[model samples]
Target: MLSTSLRVAILIGIIVYYFILIMLLRQKRLTLKYTLLWLFSGLMMLILSVFPQLLNGITRLLGIQLQSNALFAILFFCTMIILMSLTSIISKQNEAIKQLVQYTALLEKRVREIESCGD
Candidate 1:
């Protein structure tokens, strides 16, 4: 069982985490789409911290012997999801870069042809 002080600390940390996220969003440093996952995770942590019994019940249902192990499992799963999301974003950016390069090459070729014709 988590000590009362520990739970209170976790809640404070979650609040700070949320404040940072909101600040980033307002500054346009973080997009809403990307922040959604983070916001969700923070909310989950807040709930779990406020009601540790919910996690205990879930841990028992999952047949996890230790609550810490269950927490680790959840953290790992969230990490994997974030990794996959980042990968997808990278892939899309790569494709956009390729298209931009091709377009630039085409424009350069046209400019060279126009200059040669003028000469």
Candidate 2:
């Protein structure tokens, strides 16, 4: 059982997390999807920190026992890392598409110039 002071501190931390998320969204620095991930992550942490009992029932139902939160934390970190890798992959693809568009435009211009010279 967490002390009342500790519970209040967790609440404050969650509020701060949402504050940062809102600021990023307002500043156009975060997309809607990313903003939602931030919100969900904050909420998940808030719940896990404040009411870990919720997981107790889940563990009971699943017939698994764990004493530490480290595994869950590690899973969350892995998910974040995967998301980062996916974002990088998408960025590289976008760069490739942009380069292709530029090269195609240059080729079209060169072809036009050649046709004009031929006439």
Candidate 3:
């Protein structure tokens, strides 16, 4: 078992690294708003990862002591749902970019033809 101090230090390290990752995404010199979104997401993930017990904190507060196993199952389902949503969004973006690329290529080919004919 790790000492309490060590555990706290590790948690702090993880939080710092997660925040750094969000900052790196904004290294593209984009606005800070986008960076904040990433940072918030990171914080959410850290909360779920470090102290998953907080997920069930509500049950105890409500005076119903549910089994921890059930809490774990619920958390797992929540994580899966979030991941699926992300995947769906990514797929839609990919399809949109693919269509844009095809349109650009077709326009470029037409431009090339017009230039050749003008020669």
Candidate 4:
């Protein structure tokens, strides 16, 4: 069971997080696609904080012994999923960079050949 003050604190934290996220988005520091996951996480936390009973029910359903442990488990899972997503994005970007580098080299070689032929 969470104390009233603790729940209030969590709610406040979520609000602050959302505010910061929005500011970053507005400033173009964060992309919409990446921000979606963070926004979802914040919303979930806000909901859980507001309705502690829902969290308790979920923990019970999952057979988790403690609500805090359940919360940690959920957060860990979300972190793992986010990490995997980022890894995938990075892998794709790496391939694209490699392709761009190869194309640039080929273009440079063609340009040099043309210049030599002209001379």
Name the candidate that leads on TM-score.
4
Instruction: Tell me the deviation in Å of residue 84 in model 1.
Output: 1.2
Tens-place lDDT per residue, model 1, 1-119, is: 66788788878998999999999999999999887888888887787778777778878798887665666677678778888999999999999999999999999999999999999
Backbone clashes in each candidate structure, one number apiece?
Answer: 0, 0, 0, 0
* Residue pairs in collision within model 3: none
lDDT of 4 by residue, 1-119 (tens): 76788788878888899999999999999999977878887788787777777778778898987776776677677778888888998999999999999999999999999999998
What TM-score do all the candidates reach, one by one?
Answer: 0.88, 0.58, 0.49, 0.90
Can you tell me which runs of candidate 3 are displaced by over 4 Å? 1-66
Q: Write the per-residue lDDT of candidate 2 for residues 1-119, one digit (tens) a residue.
A: 33567568768987987888888889999787545655666777677667766666656666556623432653477578659966986999899999999999999999999999989
Model 4, residue 72: C-alpha shift (Å)? 2.2
Cα RMSD (angstroms) for every candidate in the order listed: 1.6, 4.5, 5.6, 1.4
The order by descending TM-score is 4, 1, 2, 3
How high is the lDDT of residue 26 in model 4?
99
- Model 3: lDDT equals 0.62
lDDT of 1: 0.84
For all candidates in order, the CA lDDT equals 0.84, 0.71, 0.62, 0.84
Which digits, one per residue and each the tens of the lDDT, describe model 3 over residues 1-119? 22356447646866797667756765755445334545555565456446656656656565545534444455466566657766877899899999999999999999999999999
